[model samples]
Target: MLQISLFRRIVIFAILIGGLVLALPNAFYTRVEQSNDARAVIESGLSNDDLSAVAGQWPDFLPSGLVNLGLDLRGGAHLLVEVQVEDVYAGRLDALWPEVRDVLAAERDTVGFVTREESGTDELRVRISEAEGAARALELVRGLARPVVTVTGAGASDIAVSADGPVLTVTLSEAERVATDNRTMQQALEIIRRRIDEAGTREPTIQRQGADRILVQVPGVGSAQEVKDLIGTTAQLTFNPVITRTTDPATNVAPDEILAPSLDEEGVFFVLERAPVVSGEELVDAQPSFDQNGRPAVSFRFNPSGARAFGDYTAENIGAPFAIVLDGEVISAPTIQSHIPGGSGIITGRFTAEESTNLAVLLRAGALPAGLTFLEERTIGPELGQDSIDKGKLAAAVGLALVIVFMGLSYGLFGWFANLALILNLCMIFGVLSLLGATLTLPGIAGIVLTVGMAVDANVLVFERIREELKTAKGPARAIELGYSRALSAIIDANITTLITASILYAVGSGPVRGFAITLGLGIVTSVFTAIFVTRLFIVLWFERRRPRTIEV
Candidate 1:
């Protein structure tokens, strides 16, 4: 048994009551207008004030429930994606590696990081490519890299290789520096998220898992396949088939000049009418929409020069086909679509509303520099997660009920004090989570249960110590003080060890593991507070009223 001071009891009551009040907004139903007003801004282009106007007001309410559950509990798709670094590098490598190979072979006899490949040398063997092409890819990769050192393959091919669990590993040649791989992966994921979000998904979670793998959780995603389909394929863009060289009206654009004309590596051969026109870079904005007649189309706007060039090009090659390519495959090749002098026109395709939006997303995010593979896809059903939650709740209830019975039987009136503290501890945990906006996953619930059990254990230690202290002829008050003082060291040591593990889990674990670690760590802190402050206060208040000379244990 233990006692608490009157002042402390009042303070505890006030704190608990305040916490519950503050947490009410996170648990109640919120309106659509409120949720929409939340800060969904991921762009820095918009000014804060401008963003504020579009974002609207903050939510005044929340869902009616025991706190919002994570995607696992509600059912959604979970994906582990490996960014296609290899494809990114392959484009640069395929185009420039040839130059490297040629330069290396021509300068084979040179020295001191020379670009020379000797006869009979392995093409991939870095001894040759490194000496010759090192500076070539180095300069280019640098342009795309962050403030990181240059990493390269043994100087052979400048290609991004493949993906490991959490990292998209690029060949040293393309990366120019090991550090850039992470930056590149991060950039790729951001692009992917933008593309997915443009298709209108809400509350999606995208995070880096390991060195190369990306974890994506889309809550309430009925369009799982669509997301994967759009993301897994790399939609790249490049300006090919330059018409600048054409001077004579009868001259035709070289086949190689046409940008990637097909998936088969064939280049386009649009009639050039011996005139140069604008490049695709003139495009400023593009959106997948419907044509004037309501046909599916991609509407695009171009700069001034583009408008003039496009108008001229169309006038000269009136009947020739101009291809609209996406990622190397031509989506449509409409014949001289009538001099769109405004540089704004449509490329019609067979697309549903969702598909149209996804295409728009891809364009808006900027095309990938290379190709990508879906490689793998996995979806987690919310039903399975709900089952785990149910089982976990059952286990927790049974364990808690048993603990309560044991404490009441072993410690009598003092046991009820521990139970009261335990209840307060639970309330504090929920309240804190509500304030923090942390999602409750299945593992997180497990942590809550574990905290409940551990919280009671502390009280048991104190009660047992008091019982033993009484045998030494100490009064109830003296025994209570001694028990707290003596048990503090063990309590701190256990908690410190647990905290260390929780920290590690938070650092190394991904997704649900991280969620669990967070709840568990917070639970320890709250447990200590309730066990020490709240329980002691209750005991002190009881002592003032009862003033028992002896205590039951």
Candidate 2:
């Protein structure tokens, strides 16, 4: 009575063949990886003869997806960086100064002449010439305060205003500071992720650690310094109104002015306004292109708001030099020959093509909200990863061999069927991983080894049950049917419990732990299918062909 229908048999064989086909690329990982890379280049419209040759290493008809290797397996850069959230406070205060100046200037009759006063990094202070109108100055500044947007900060004003004599002090409220900190962290994480993705790295782990720390692990990068060079630069680009050109590094400037060294000329400096006409945040697109002289340069376009502001500034300040600043340094100070209306401009400097391309990428990714201080950095070598891979292979092979030998010795011919199912179960695991584009770590390899033993456990349970049923004087066919039917509940119960544990691990854990959980959970599913269905199908075929009347357990 134990039999598989023709339809069921076809389904089983189809799954086996499909899994094997999907998993075939992993057998030629290096060749397939090169082919994939070359294909990507070709698709990006930058293909060459060498790239075409490399892409042809693998057939076009086969699946090219691969199981991505984790940082532990592929070697990469690891960094722990602390975001300087306080830096954003200073920038916010700087931006608030122009609005405060304009507001107080509107009430010049009551508040008198207003000038920005030097204060703490987190506070903005405005001094009025008339001490009697202190209350009026404070009231005007407080009017600029907006309600914080965060739930916890609801009803709280973003800026707290107070008066001391003729000086009006403005600082971010406690709740607003907390809200800003959260926003800064989120923005920093997003910018870092974009920068790494723009660089075309695979399987990067970019996540927040504590309050201000970010952990970055980029697989396949050359070194930690290389990664630092990629993401560390704030790339804060701005166009500020140039006050005057100077050769002195220690030139005195007003509170609203900044003295920045020119990037092209060593000793030449430019004194510029602290507030910019348009910042990098308003940029909509940036690309690497050649300037009029055919030199490497970066071209950029602005959003609607940015275009309006840039157009107004250029129109009003024709014949005056406008400083293009990047992270506090004046990269270029070019004279505005005419009004540029379209909000499109080119930045030309002493740059190689590669540098210009990298600048374009950073510009497109947007600027980081805050500065990053590298707390720790490490570069893992591929040699170490290769060693780990070699050891992991040895352990998995040894465990698999031992399990196969034990099953073959214990249960005779039925054991051979179980061993074959175990092999297919592993192939299915790889197939699923490849299909999902999962990363494989050292711990993930251990999960696969553990699965090799677990894969045959259901077979062991069913074989032992058959031996017991045979002792009860049942016929071979009846005993085989009862054995599988009786063991089904136990097999399902055991695998279900393990799968729950794996799910929990995956939900709460990160990096290596998640890798292990993924492999373990996937292994449990494939193991149950192979043991209960594939092995049973094989036994059913053998029995149907032989029609044996009696059998040895």
Candidate 3:
């Protein structure tokens, strides 16, 4: 009666063998990781002979994926950054000036001359020459408003325009502010991720903390300050038309122009138009290259719209100078020698090779939505990570040893069968993790150790049930059948309850707590599978071979 079908037996063995095969690559993690990195480099068109050769070291068809280690297991930097969202509001108002001017200019006869007023940085104000025309100007500016894209803001305008005497005040509506803040936060998250990825660091945790904050964690990074520097640089590259060259930095300039000092020349300043002919957002590609004079430079190509704008501006401006500005600083001001119609151009600023490469990386990653203020930063050293890993391994070994010894002593032969299943269960956990590429943290090691003990609990329950059935005058085969049958409900119920708890922990927790929940949840599944099916198969095979009349559980 304790017989397993050929299909069932094959499935159980196949699972055990498949798990071992998949988990084998992790034992040689360094080699596998090297192969993976080499493949990435070759695929990215890096043209490294050594890397390309190493890419084939691991077979293409093998399970080469390894479990990623968390920040605690591997040394890394953690950062809490607060995005300055309000800074965007000031820039937004500045950008809206041109649109407002164009709209009001359409009805200049009715409103008379309109002048922009210097109000609070948070608001945009324009004064009408005729006080009686305030209503008409307000209506024209209000006509520029668009409907808000939020559920709570139905029928509300994007901007609130009010007429206070002759001056019309404009502020971003509550709905628009919410939308802008959300976009800023999401853009910040994506840009941070791209920057870290560009730096070649592995498995960074970039997430939004709140409405105005981001959390960044990078494994194998040298210091937290390095990550902060990489993320905090706005890298807002723009090409603005040169208004004039000036020596006075504080010269009174029009509102549409800004004065920025030259990077290479002393006491030299360039007044540049505020509006950019081409912004970094339109840049599709950027790379480090050498100029005609053999100086390091950055070559960039823009998207279609940007290419058209840049081409038209360059064709018209001919010999006029244009400034390449980055983060409000003038990097270079060069005269347009010819029309650059291909949308590609070089930026030469006496850059070193490393500087050019770094700039290119920053450009390719795109600009941050808002400047980041580092709220908290810390570095976890490799020594600390190694110590944690050693302690975790020791704990797991001790836990596994104790569980195996206890099961061997209590259940005799059946206990040894459970012990074998437990060993296979450990391999299956790692196999699943490697397959999923889940991150393993220090707390995750604790989950595995906890699982080692709980794995035998089902076996204990079944053995106890068998003893009870024997006392009820049941034969050896009947007792074994009844034991497995009746103990099924308790095993399913207990595992399901633990799984639910792990799910809640994973959903609510962040970082290491989530790692713990992941391993705990995975361990529960593997433990249940091994206990209910694998150990039963082993017991069934033994009984089938020996044909025992009376057996001791």
Q: Which candidate is the best by TM-score?
A: 2
Which sequence of candidate numbers ranks them by lDDT, best first?
Answer: 2, 3, 1
Candidate 2: stretches off by over 4 Å: none
Give lDDT: candidate 2, residue 540.
94
Error of 3 at 68 (Å): 1.4
Count steric clashes of candidate 3: 0
* TM-score against native, each model: 0.65, 0.96, 0.94
Q: Cα-based RMSD of the predictions, in order? A: 9.9, 1.6, 2.1
Query: In model 2, how large is the Cα lDDT of residue 415?
Result: 96
| Per-model lDDT | 0.63, 0.94, 0.89
Best by lDDT: 2
- lDDT by residue (284-316, candidate 2, tens digit) is 999999999999999999999999999999999
* Candidate 2 clashes between residue pairs 3 or more apart in a chain or in different chains: none
Give me the runs in candidate 1 sitting further than 4 Å from their true place: 1-11, 18-72, 93-183, 196-219, 237-324, 330-353, 366-370, 469-474
Model 3 stretches astray by more than 4 angstroms: 46-61, 472-474
lDDT of 3 by residue, 102-149 (tens): 888788888878778777767998887888888889888988999988
**Native-vs-model 3 lDDT?**
0.89
**lDDT of residue 97 for candidate 1:** 39
